[model samples]
Target: MKLLLTLCFTCALLITAESLNCHVCANQNCSTSTSVACPAFSVCSTVTLLRRSGTSTTVTVNKNCSTLPSCPSLLGSETEWSVNQGFAREARRQLCCITNDCNMRTLAVPNSVINGRQCPGCASSAESLNGSCNATVSCEGVEDRCFNSTTLNSTQLMIRGCISNNLCVLQAIFGDLLSGSIDITCGAPCSYRMSTLLLTFAVAAHKVLL
Candidate 1:
């Protein structure tokens, strides 16, 4: 009865709010973009994820309705935050707004914040993106989650080190977007092993500075 009543209330809210309209695209410029109606319970979003090695960087952009709880609406630039582990780093920027088709502007990677933390992990490139865990990393701001995950398919790729909570949500939801079995574990617990030789770590984050 209680659950039913809550559902009823939620449904009433959605009926009043209707559905949000957002842009849906990937790896495209959105300066002058088109729009599409989102699902019954989602919000407009433009999320960008990047992985960098030394001076080389790769970026992927996605615009669609999101159900992520963390990224509400910043209204401005992305938090100049990122995560770095040894040879590789991961950074994210999001532009979200409430209204009809508000995801405009091509967001650039903001300035990085040096929070003075260190971690260890492995990273790879989009091209030959599978490598062994043979690196120590420098953890960045808001990258409170230490990730150690792998893709369990024909081509198994292992990923590790500190990461952001936003990436956690995306990896969980879109782990299988590529053609393979992928496992993404961030800020894991203790240490585990995908196999005998392959060891993974999980550090408990407390009063995490994001």
Candidate 2:
């Protein structure tokens, strides 16, 4: 009977070894966290999110277990979006690893610097729902693409902004954690004017030479 009890205890430890363990926290500093075992093929992830409206910026952090296949490549990467030039913005950074309790790091949002591309901008509010987005904003940093996003929840909130090329990929993987279940549609490249003008100038010079 004692031998059977010992074997049962060994089996339990073996089962626990097969699962990944990760720290879970949802505070700005991640000062306190709890370790929990994750499901099969899971990885430990730590994410930081920043939301800005005008001069007010709010930062939040969450660390937990994730099953995203792209987690490995997404480590230490950040994405950003903005509306009204710099009036409203959002940024997220993620760190993911496959080893048990490996996501012990924390991330913070980076500052924004304008990159000169322009896009129509509007914040999510009653006025924006009417499609009266005549205002434009200078795109910032790696945010060379324009985007229109609407939440899938009952509120159906809408926002138009500038974003990085990988923002969409992160949104697809992170879902509600990034911005809720958002339906995002990206617009055409916003920095085409300079190229178009250069092409026109080259053509004119060729005609003159002929």
- The ten-residue window of minimal lDDT in model 1 covers 198-207
Q: Which candidate gets the maximum lDDT versus the true structure? A: 2
| CA shift of 70, model 1, Å | 12
lDDT for model 2: 0.65
Model 2 lDDT tens row, 1-210: 999967854654454346888999845567778888897656678877677776787888888987555452433344343333235676666677666787777665654677768877764445456655556767765677887777777666556767776665556643443446877787468853356778899999999999
Native-referenced Cα lDDT, model 1: 0.58
Query: Which stretches of model 1 miss by more than 4 angstroms?
Result: 1-28, 34-42, 58-86, 95-98, 105-111, 123-132, 166-171, 174-180, 188-210
Instruction: Please report how far candidate 2 places residue 62 from its true position, in Å.
Output: 1.3
Q: Determine which window of 10 residues in candidate 2 has minimal summed lDDT.
A: 76-85
TM-score of 1: 0.54
Q: What is the Cα root-mean-square deviation between model 1 and the actual structure?
A: 10.4
Tens digit of per-residue lDDT, candidate 1, span 104-201: 55566543555444455764454226565666555665665566667777776665666656556665333533335677666553222234333222
Pairs that collide, model 1: 85-137, 86-137, 146-187, 188-202
